[model samples]
Target: MADIARRPFLRHLRAETTSYVQHLRNGEVRHAGAGIAFWFRPATAALAEVPLDDREQTLLFHARTADFQDVTVQATVSVRAVEPALAATRIDFGIDPRTGRWRAAPLEVLGGLLTELAQQPALDLLATLGMAEALARGLAPVRDRIAEALAADPRLAERGLAVTDVRVVAIRTDPEVERALQTETRERVQQEADRATYERRAVAVERERAIAENELANQIELARR
Candidate 1:
């Protein structure tokens, strides 16, 4: 059984876990798996592990819109780790810098990175649109743009982090700006209503004038006859 003794040990990886098997010989990634596995020598081997299951996350940050207005952006995101080893590189994994002991959780590290990534695109998109227009247009385009931007980023792909969906929970501006937009919208609606009423009144006046002229002409014809 000397041949069997020399072989690497078997590591069990569940379906919901992402795994990265590395070879210590040359410091190269020996294998990467999502719901999969690979064999490696244990003495010189270093393995980094992360969860592959779905995760829900959130972001609460402030960013300025195109109109130079400060706004608070709240967003919700769903993410899954596709490359646990790559993601592990980006995350500290709660390792103590001094002693190299574990302290923090993986989710925490992922959350911080996700928060930064999620906010950058959102802020960028918001900066291109005016604050009032952002509120008026709603969050559909904002969500789409953020998702697309995240998909295009090479770093996220390298880390094997997949952003499933991003949603803008709320975008809040200064109270004064909100009131100003409301007042402007109210005034515009009122003006349109007033214009419609004036048009209807003008049409009624013209109809009445026409009816009165017809009545007068009929009266004159009767008198002549």
Candidate 2:
């Protein structure tokens, strides 16, 4: 009887709780999410998983407005590795394939890229809007623009990075700039109030003069009659 060659057995694979996986076998690589059983030669298969869930981080950036006033922007950036192969090649995944042992994790690479992409667009937008408009509109509008700019970037896609969410947490003026704005607002309000008071007093004086003239007319009529 001839000996028969045994085929590679099927095995179950589960993605990490918050991660995704690239299953590579026999010169083919497949991206997978969740658990699915598949057949692969144990010796030839490579399974790499990186976090799929977005990682949240805060970054503070400084940009000068068109008026040459400096402003501080605080933002929350949510990023994730979307392409398994690019991520594996670009970032140091801590686990050593042979040892499967703990290694000091590498710094976040995707986050840095996302920050770079977001910062310039934000600054450019601020330049167009100027300081007053930026402060007046607040972060909501800017957040949307930043997020859109990041999403539409082809470079990010090439690097296998994605910005899931970006929040303009706050945009702060320099302390001196803030005080100046506040003082200007206060003075304008005061001026408006003073104008109102003056107008009220003028109206009162006119009413009083009208009443006196009527009284005089009545007195003169009474005497003439």
* TM-score computed on alpha carbons, candidate 2: 0.68
lDDT by residue (95-178, candidate 2, tens digit) is 433333223453345557667888988888888777887787858877987899888999877867788788898999978888
RMSD of each: 7.1, 7.5
Using TM-score as the measure, the top candidate is 1
Q: 147-208 in candidate 1: lDDT tens per residue?
A: 88778887678877898878888888889989999999999999999999999999999999
Give the clashing residue pairs of candidate 2, or none: none
Q: For model 1, what is the error of residue 91's alpha carbon versus the real structure, in angstroms, after optimal superposition?
A: 2.8
TM-score of 1: 0.70
